[model samples]
Target: MSFSIIFFFVFFVSILFCFSNSDEVYVINTNGTKIIGRKFFTVFEDKPYAAFWKIPYAAPPVGKLRYKPPNPLRWLDKPVYNYSIPYNESCASGRTEDCLYLSIYTPIIKHIFDFPVVVWIHEDAHKHSPDFLIDEEVIVVTISLRTSIFGFLNTGDEFAGGNMGAKDILTALRWIRDNIGHFSGDINKVTVFGSESTAPIVASLLVSAAGEDLFQRVIIQGGSALSPADYRNYNFEIMNKLYWNLDGPFEKFNRTKLYELLSKSSTKKLLVASYDLFDSTEVRDNQRLINSFPLTVELSGKGAFMNKFPLEVYKRKITNNAVEVMIGYTNLDSLHKLDGFVRNRKLLKYLNYNFQYLLPFEGRRDEYGSKLYKKIRRKIMDFYFVNGTVGERSLRRFAKYMSDQVIYPILRQATLHSQVSCNNVYLYRFTYQGSFSLVWNTVLRNLNFSGATSGDEICYQFKCKSLSTAYNAEETSNERLFIKKMARLLGNFAKHGNPTPHSSDDILDGLQWLPLNPAKSVRLLNMGRELKMIKLPEAKRMEFWTQLRNEFFPDRRINDEL
Candidate 1:
């Protein structure tokens, strides 16, 4: 052969060798069958893994299952073989009830090494699709469950119960525990991680007696157990009333008739109805049912809905000593609520109108409410992006409210009840504000901000395209190091029940990660590029908690003096 021909042949062989080395295989679960997943790299050398898109976790909660608890699938004798595409029907254009399938990613292991398992619960106000979190490295798994009407329609009558989605999650976790080992995962070292709305769902598992043993460690990012205000007294009767208003009047609706109506409704109708209701003040309050204490007997009748009360569950199962917990929130989680506003001027006005009507007291009406809303949104954007507050008053107030109502209380209760070591209950507040050009350009529509906001951390840990879009030179380096740190933190927590070795030196320092204290309000984990701890004044923390208790639970106060 000529020298030129030989050189060309050598170059072709080198390229082929590189391509072969880059390919990775994943094994996923479809019903009771298994299928192979092949992942390849894109032109930018970005990793892309495509498995069957959407799969069902339970039988479609349609027909007889509508408004009732989720029922597991019954196996058939047909030999199951294909895992090439997702098994469930597509989520309507935006959201769907047909989303009941789970995706599994099993990494290739050359040796006999047992890898820890991480199960991710995707976040979308419990209404959107779950395509943003399919990764290849850590055996990423996600499931689609009933949302809105199908998941949480609380009709006091026996026909419709709340928490269908949570029950779906439990079923999925049980599936993982029983079968994940076959995919090279350790059944005992499973860690459940969720972002945004899904975080509370994982917190429910941590506190629920029914779900306590499903996994060993819990990681909640961005969201918490706090419920929306309107749905605090959620019950089947209330749900029936709400449904009747949306669909028709109650006289026209019977339990069986309603179920049939819902069954026939396309998944798109269900999704639209759910989003519509979410926009309503009444529905928002009802959604908050999980956050309050002394849940009415009506709410607890639904088995998994009771899991929403983490404080109550912690009190009852205080001594159940079997799990580890890690909790964190992004600096500008509130910005997630404002992204639509930033992207669309029409949406901003629409949101302002909705929120103004939602607020209980109406002394100042539009002027005060609109101003407050604008200030709050701006503060959220600034803090999350620039890490510099134009003014401290708004952020301080918001932080105080969040801490008093949800974050601080949960941490205090968990610390008080936990029999495990201090390290077992890890807490963090992500403040690493920077910019990801690609992520901003693509997924976020070029909204420039950074430092682990909302579900951003998931992008780092999982090999998903959502995070890849945000890659710039600075972010690329940060992403690689952050991924290693996060994965190690999670893996270590799963292996040994603690986030890290408990020695003083080993504990994260200079980051202001002090122990949680309800009284002094000292523990606030600032997880920015340089972590710091900010101690809320004792008087301020107590005052905020007192105000929240008065507003939400006048009958049960936390003794102002105490």
Candidate 2:
């Protein structure tokens, strides 16, 4: 062959070799379908492991199934494989019907030894899309489900049942039990974990009959059952009114008409209308209006759902010894108090002004306003560390109130309940301020007040690739240590159904995890590495929560005393 031809041949072969090595292939289980996934490597136990991303576990929940429970697909037919980029559609924001899908991440090649499964439910206050739960190690699965109206609409009729979102979770669990073994996962060693709003739902499941036996381990971070009182006051009457108002009459408000109207409306409009009766402010602001309803209302709604059909299968409590539960909150979880309207002065003033007149307790409006302001400020400090911003003064007060009424009480209850219910229950308070940069950001001039707010912790827990990008250098180092601690605890729990080795010292410290025993629950405050377990002054914790509950939700029956 000519020298030029030989040179071209060698170059072509070299390019092919590089391209082939760069790509990773995945094989479908049935009928030999195959596709190439992006190849990435991560260091695991000093060994490199390959990972594949975005494997689907359920058919898209678009169109007719939009507001309904998830129906996972079976791979019974020939594997229909295409290398086309997998579905990464952003979750339906307002009233989207196209938000059904699940993603899977696993080691490229499964070994004979089965690995534990860690399924994460992403937290967007349960509003955002499902792409947030992408982790490379231990098989990670996340599914998109209906949020807002489609998920939790309470028509207050036998036909309008709540828990469509929860039913989605059940479907995902059943899928795991039936198919995860094929991925070299032990069906029995599944752990479910999430933060914020997701945490509360998971906790509810732990206590509810519907959630029994769905997973062997559960972790709740930063959220509890102490939701707002307004959420529960869902006016099913409003749904009927809006349905008729939009469709023009009852004859047109049938399922077909309802679906047609829903299909035509924007996701935002649907959410606003769905929650208009519960809180007009939420509708005006386009926030999660229904979610802002009273916690008492939510508990009652859940109870009603449970009463309608006893989850017979889930009620058979298979030994309280069967599952391991870990519940915790951040050292400064009150930071979330600043998440919404507090950031906007106009909105705050508007809400304060409106409430001053519309609310029956007009005289106490200033007190409520002050309380909300304090919570915002404290949340700013706890999450971002920098205060002294434009809204700092108001936010500080809001943060304080939130800490006293929401964060502390919720953590205390979880700790107490777990301790009393299961010997294996473990509780923790993440006091580590993470990296110094993160701490510095809390104080950095213009930049300091700009970033690092509540919900920032999520940046580190999942999808973070570098400590530098994740947090400040010094703070990143601290965060690394903290992550290590968290991962160790999680891994240990998955392995033995206990958070740490069965040692007396560990057990003692574990036991000291602030009890929820209404009379003696302690709130563990972690400062740096030091831990201080302080008993919540009995009068403050119980009395305050009781008063708050009664004042906020007089018509509803709620277990807020805890």
Question: Can you give the TM-score per candidate against the true fold?
Answer: 0.68, 0.67
Those runs of model 1 whose alpha carbons end farther than 4 Å from true positions after fitting are: 1-34, 39-56, 74-80, 86-96, 124-137, 226-233, 236-257, 278-310, 315-321, 338-423, 437-453, 467-475, 502-524, 532-543, 547-562
Tens digits of per-residue lDDT, candidate 2, 24-65, equal 444335334433334444422222333334445556655666
- lDDT (tens digit, per residue) of candidate 1 on 1-562: 9975686567445434544552444444555554444454431224454443343456776667776776776433222333444343332224545567776654454563365667777743223212222222345566666555666665555665566667778888887777666566777777888776566666665556667677877877755443333123454444465467547764755667665656677766655545543334443343232321112223444364463344444344443356677777654444444444445535433332333222211012224335654554443334322343323223333333333334444444344434333335666766554443223334455554443335555444454544444444554766555444555455556566555554452324312234444344345556556545564323354443445445444533122221
Count of backbone collisions within predicted model 2: 40
lDDT of each: 0.50, 0.48
Candidate 2, 243: how far from true, in Å?
A: 4.3
lDDT of candidate 2? 0.48
Error of 2 at 314 (Å): 15
- lDDT at residue 498 of model 1 (Cα atoms): 58
- Among all candidates shown, the one with the greatest lDDT: 1
Candidate topping TM-score: 1
Residues forming the 10-long window of minimal summed lDDT in candidate 2: 356-365
